[model samples]
Target: MAPQTSETEQVVDLNSWLPITASRKAKWWYSAFHNVTAMVGAGVLGLPFALSQLGWIPGIVAILGSWLITFYTLWQLVELHEAVPGKRFDRYPELGEHAFGPKLGYWIVMPQQTCVQVASTIVYSVTGGKSLKNYSMVAFIASTIRGSHHHPATYGVRSHTTAGQIFDVLNGIGTIAFAYAGHSVVLEIQATIPSTQKNTSKKPMWKGCVVAYIIVALCYLAVSISGFWAFGNVFAMPVFDMLESCLVQKLHFTPGRALRFAGRSTYVAITGFIALCIPFFGGLLGFFGGLVFASTSYFTPCIIWLVLKKPNRWSFHWIASWISIIIGVLIAVLAPIGGIRQIIISAKTYKFFS
Candidate 1:
């Protein structure tokens, strides 16, 4: 048998194992976009309905609270980055380990990360499905209006008359799928940024964070306004509210073609957009895989590395992707759409505590 590796060698190996990879680096923009998208996506889509339920002041307050939480979390992440110059914020568990003891860091952060991943996934899947159904209904309505006196094609597309239970399920599944796709993007971002030997100035990074926050805030606000105005007391998803808003007005140039073929085509196109997002479901699965890497693969191993001060060739990165895929598949099969929705929405409430 070969001589046993030294403890020093093991620590080096572990450090190398956790080093940010290339794939994450290459797709930084997409990852950043995913961050923003996941944060605001379903929230915006359902803001109008939520606003109607809670009223404007309450809605605004909730959104403001969300923004405050986002700012605080992001600030903490930045501080972590500053504290450890070379480490990536995506590897939050490592940062925690460094600041707190290894056990404390792992115990505190790992579970939180897991909760975030699972909850975000559920929200994405559920909202995505609801958005799809809403757009489908819009398309159906437009089609009927256009083909009223002409050739009526029996597409069999009906409005969503499903019970509350079914609606909840589909929404949750869609939300999870959305969150999963989002997590994958974060891994890609974490891998891409070059690991610096010394701490860099936080100005540029902070600027990016500020811009992102503002954009997210505005988007959420717009969706909330548009959704509530359109739905007017109907507790529908924000996407449905937006569609309803869009349908109310006629074209300035073509007054006679209010509900014409062109209008129907536009509605269909919107529905198609939602349909195309089905691929994102797969993306979400990949993201959850990345989270598994961060949690089981990255966080746990890093803790061991800290204590052992040695590196192991076996790293969490290797199996993280596959593990995520498996979990996602199992969830897809076993949970059903409703279960997914419940998980996602329930997770959303955690934002209050986060």
Candidate 2:
């Protein structure tokens, strides 16, 4: 039999289709918007709060350091996506599977990626609900004032105990981690762009990503600086695709509108309920960032790059990878300590569905 062409291979199959890999007609600008949107969501708003906890120097270091590290890791992921000719690792776990053994990589990466998506949905839900509520209060105040009113903005005031300050710094690191949580879906976003043998997807995807990161830097710089001075904040629908893929591809269920509607709606309802239960997630930024986002966005790519590239000893890539991993692991461990503490504190006063 003759080798099938890439065109013959890419024919859409609804039965085995997943949302993230379904669309392959996006232009470079689509990636710019998608990445910008993915990278600048609920977490961006928390950066100010994150900066406040870390103090001036440490916080600046953390922000600039994270930006640089994440950018490098992102480049590594893009290069690896098409390292093998004619094959693409669309999902993060797929890349992990390539670097490590399939089962081991899946186990190592899947949990972290899944957690990032699930936790993000919960955070977004809380942020969305509170935003409207806050807007209403502002609107009411405006009505009474009859014009624009400037209120004193209190940011970065340190009044916590010694231990509390420590926890806050750790939490702040997690918040910073949260802000750069874009790695999980980089390949997924790139997958949308059309790739050819002559012109691979990475070229266009990287171009767009560069733009997105630029926007991220501009927004974060002002937000983070002003917040500390002032304060500071993905997947292309991974949760939906993951669930549908499991049902349709893993379990051999038929893929159709009904299944999608039911599954997607259930996911929404669950995330909403969790959001309602918490009602406030300001403290969760660090917890989720450290617990899972760091693994998915910060260190996982670095580890995979080291495994696959095997850069020479003490080389630039090698040293940078190690440094990133070290910091990422610390953030994963220490940031979550404060996050869990914050959760416990919040839980004590939190009311169910109130």
- Clashing residue pairs in all predictions, respectively, total 36, 10
Give the Cα-based TM-score of candidate 1 against the true structure: 0.46
Q: Give the TM-score of candidate 2.
A: 0.88
Deviating ranges (above 4 Å) for candidate 2 = 1-16, 133-157, 228-236
Candidate 1 lDDT, 93-188, residue by residue in tens: 555566567899746655545444443444355445544544323433443444454543322211143554343333333222322222222322
Task: Tell me each candidate's TM-score.
Answer: 0.46, 0.88
- Candidate 1's C-alpha runs over 4 A off are 1-32, 85-90, 133-191, 195-204, 234-354
RMSD of 1: 19.1
Residue range 45-68, candidate 2, lDDT tens digits: 777677777777788888888889
| C-alpha lDDT (0 to 100) for residue 213 of candidate 2 | 92
Report every candidate's CA lDDT.
0.41, 0.80
